[model samples]
Target chain A: MAEERTPLYRRLSRRHLFRLPLLHSRNGKRRWPIRSAGINFALGYGVLFLISATLFLSFIWWSSTNLLNDHVRAFIETDAQELRHRWGHGGAPALSEAINDRLEQNIDDDALYLLIDRHGRRMAGNLPGWPVAVKKMNHFYELTIRRYTFTTPAQFKAYTLPHGFKLIVGHDIRGRTLLSTVITRTLIWCAVMISLLAVGGALVVRDLFRRMVGSIARTASAVANGDLNHRIALTGSETDLVAETVNTMLDRINRLMEGVRQVSNAIAHDLRTPITRARNQLEEAFFSATSPDELRTAVDRAIGDLDHITGIFEALLRIAQIEAGARRSAFTTVNLNQLLSNMAELYEASAEDAGLSLALDVTPLPSLFGDERMLQQALANLLDNAIKFSPPNSMLTLSAHPVMAGTAPGSGAEKKPQGLEISVRDQGPGMNDADILRAHERFFRAESARNTPGSGLGLSLVQAVTSLHHGRLTLTQANPGLKVTLFLPLLPEAERTGRSTTPAETTP
Target chain B: MRILLVEDDPTVRSFVLKGLKEAGHNVDQADNGKDGLYLAIGEKYDIIILDRMLPGGIDGLNILETLRGQKNNTPVLLLSALSDVDDRVDGLRAGGDDYVTKPFAFSELLARVEALGRRGHNESAPETSLTVGDLTLDLLSREVRRDGQKIDLQPREFRLLEFLVRHAGQVVTRTMLLEKVWDYHFDPQTNVIDVHVSRLRQKVDKPFETAIIHTVRNAGYILRPTQD
Candidate 1:
């Protein structure tokens, strides 16, 4: 029923498996045979198998034929030696009698003998006459002779005896010839069998390869068609590695796409509120304002709201730009010591005004290559958050030191430091586990920070700047406070020096 | 002061023209880059405010480059909607004296324009010492003295005072102070600039009988000999 359910052309093609065309047109487009890796693999395997099998069979045929020829030559040499001795002891007549006796004693009837006189006339032999082709004495030759009713091919050796009599000793090789012919016939049959097996094996291999890759191809096409949920099923085969890697990549892409979607949604929600608020305020002022002062106050407030909205827009655009790595070109050799101190001094007065004491603990460090302005901005955001959350008289500790890669916070490893760790700890109502996990998400305001007057993009911008520097940002609860650490890797000398210098602005 | 205003948007152009005229400046208006360039070249203006994107074939940068190439030394402040740092760099690299992104407060524009106008007049001679009322700033010694009484200041504070004293009687915004004094460009989330100015005021104004650094509501800070 299933076979009948398929299209008629598919069913017809399925019946003639061997006649399957390597190249077929689908939807009016010709599919190239070479495009199929399975077909290429099968062809290569089949050709190699055929060549090796032919060589092996040829080796067997040559060795077997040589063994049979050697056996015949050994027998002819021994028989000729014994007959020559007989001719020497009993003369030509004795040799002729001996040759007849051997012929009569031959149970297999494969013996051949011939004795020629000085004038080259055959005296005693199974052959009709001296072979005209056997012109030399003491040499082996092959000739046909009449054994009984049938003529058979035989190997012979002509030997010169006393009184110029030539005695030719030979053996009938019809059995050996038949055996060799049978071996040749069997080898040919085997070659044909091997060729058939190779082709069948190739088909099996190609089928397996296609089945493995077909799953992946189907999943990819499904994804291309907007079905991102489709995934290649793992078959526990060697191809599972590739399938797993592809699945992992798809998961990452899905996550990124989801992030983009969420950001768009958040932007719409975030921007709409202020815009609606501003519009409503202006509309209300237009209809109700009876005095210029009242109208002016309403307009000023609207402008302030608009400015706040603009600030949010600028922050979002900067974060997006930084995440896109567009600001990397502005990287330069920044003196960390000077930068940290300047930032500390710049923000110290603000922290003091907020009734918080700011402490800076920066160890002597080498120069860092980065966009000083961006790093400063990130630090400013962190400090801003710290001061905003901290209670009066609380100490905001901003510290920086060198750290080795892979070493956790406060772990003292003896290895050389490979990166810089800058942390800001604030004594505030720290975030919970869930909020900490999502603190860097754009527009994610923590419960403790819900009342704070911020656009909720501070940490996101910090995250963007950290990632742009090939760094990692982590937030951990510092027992009574929260600690935000930015771990920036130290670029190697080659990378630092290899950067192309951007053109500087000329003074007018 | 004579000012040239080049903007394509009628709303923004009329608003800026009205503001400049109200501020007692002779203003020349052009709706496109072609007329703007012609007016800028034909007249000697104290400042030229050029919009980055114009309707005509010529652009703000093109006019700027042509003027600079001809050694026209009038300071040009670029008004643009492109707010990226690279865009600002491109504008400045093309001989723009300053860049103000769109959606700007008129006060910021006026402040920057007045600053640019003052810069053209102040470039004629270099002064070793600047005096604003009783406040004196020694350029060679990096010393600031009020009423001939030496006032010790930190290195950063001296630079801040020098910038303020040089642009005396001008409304200097927080961004200007941040860029000119700290050599950094970015908006601090909080009023950090206010804190710094307060610190400066504590030393320069708190002890003195006269206050020099006065905050302009909704604008920034202005350092004058006397308060308004």
Candidate 2:
């Protein structure tokens, strides 16, 4: 029912008045001017110059036309008066002979004269309306004569007379009008020339801008392709804000790459020693092992050492993967209560074996978004450290609960509702403030706990995994022990709706 | 019994060759896996000691794999420096009878080779309870008794005495102690081997009138029967 919309190209061309005929003609003709930004600028300059020149020339033309008319009228009037005087005394023969002789001597041929008496009779004049239009005096009229335009004015003052015999004088202005036309054509031609020159100027500027953009694009492509070594050559002035920002970005990238290289080198160096030790131990056992019991014992102990080296490598790799932000894609809704209960069950036996008691108190917690494996690994590491450091028969308590509205961290200062907090507490050798602060550093053994067996990577791995999940891990002293608390965002559904879910419980 | 020992290091090769000869086994030495494999195939030996990683083209695993592929079950005991879980699994899976990481004890090696020999011939099972000089070990009970007096032994001490008694006259290096007693395949930075051996010596050597465990200078321990 609705009319179909016109094609965009057709509509645009129609609106621009670029009809088919005009387009065909334009295409066929070889135009010296190209219409681009450069051409537009030149055309604008030329048009402005032309307008100014036209106004000035038009003014000159109008004044000159008036002056030339006035001078020619006065000469015509003087000749007419002199002829009239001679004709009135002598006869027609004398007047005719004098006018014809004057006509032969005139150079501009634009001048015309007419003379008439009170009887309205035509005397010596090239025009027929000698004194009829001049009777009212000083009347100007534009007349079309012989396919040309002429201005005619009759002046009563230009006529002089004795009593009943009056002499009328008139002038033609066609020659002055023709001269004004010539001036107009010259000004228009000059305007077109200047406009073309402006187009050329705009083209030069356009080319310069294109070149600058091209170089920038090329450098950007190189950087995008992972050649961090490539840097953009600074073109233009330092004042260019785009150049400044790009250079700053490149500098940051270079620094980051250097840091990555250093870290990998350090890791490789540290890892090689343990791996080499594991290898040499195996060789000794193979040659001298005399009994099956001796050989089996040797192989088992080597595997243990090998497992340690593999653990270190895996921990390093996990940290790097977490830092890369690629694992965020694996995020899913996680039930914190279930996770805590499972962890408590797994670690409680190990803790008791180490002479440490593990306690778990789980309250209602909204599910969180996270990778389950990574979260479990992180929590396991934390618990491993807690149980390892705790003295014989020390209690390690793990609890998860909603950070109740009023009792939440920052209390009323926080914008959102309370988050969910899970904490692992141990009644063991608590670290000082400085050790707690440096606890998350890699391979950093606490001065007080240096005697303990650990690789010192547990807490660092926890920190990396915690930050990656957009959660916060904080360490605080439990007066006589160390407590680690993690705060994670509550699930979207249970958080904003304020619905309470059933709490899950765990036993020590 | 004739044994073929393939090792690259000169010191290790000579030490092993001497230890094998002293243990009353004929020893043939090869520097690399290629020559070792050639000699192993060309001439028959009771057992072959092949290093897992060798300097030449044929690695220990490759040589072992090639021998087994040709239906040669010559009982290879693989020796390697790569003492990782995966490396051990790979060596065993690649047709090796037994695998030992580097720096191994000569006594353990001699015992394993003897076991391998016993395995090839369907001979009578070796004694479950073994006796050397004044010491007696009950394999079933995991107990050690000297002259009708009961001796308490830790797991490691028990295992050490068992190995020493099994290869009574062989020389075992500290490197061998790390590999066999501690189950470590590489050199230990700590003097863990010496510490454990001293503890064993306190239990097994200190109380006995005739000591069986002897420390050989710059070599290893030798558990030989008393000459009286």
TM-score each candidate. 0.66, 0.42
Write one digit per residue (lDDT tens) for candidate 2, span A1-508: 0011123223333443434233334458744333344434544554566567767887888898778767765665576668777778766656656766766776756545555555867666565554333444443433444313534333233444554444444445566667867987776566556544644555675576657666667777888998877766776653246765776677666755754674587477766766777777788888988998988887877776776776676566566556555566567788777778866755665676666778878775667777676777777777877876778977999887777466654334344445777788888888888888888766667887777666667777777777666667888999889999877655466442332221112110
Docking class for model 1 is medium
Evaluated at residue A323, the lDDT of candidate 2 is 57
* Candidate 2 runs further than 4 Å off: A1-259, A286-288, A291-293, A352-355, A367-369, A401-415, A447-453, A489-508, B1-228
lDDT per model vs. reference: 0.83, 0.68
Q: Per-prediction RMSD in angstroms?
A: 9.6, 20.2
Total clashes for model 2: 34
Compared with the real two-chain complex, what DockQ does model 2 have? 0.02
- A1-508 per-residue lDDT for model 1 (tens digits): 1222123223323543445455667676666434435444544564565566567766876887678668888998888888888877988888889988888889987777788899988888777787778888777777776666887788878777878888877878887668667766765566556445645665677788878999999999999998888888999999999999889777756755665676688788898988998999999999999999999999999998999899898888898777655688898998989989999998999999999999988876668889988999999999999999998899999999887667864455576678898999999888888888988988889987878889899998888888877788899998778999998878887876564322122110
Model 1's lDDT to the true fold? Answer: 0.83
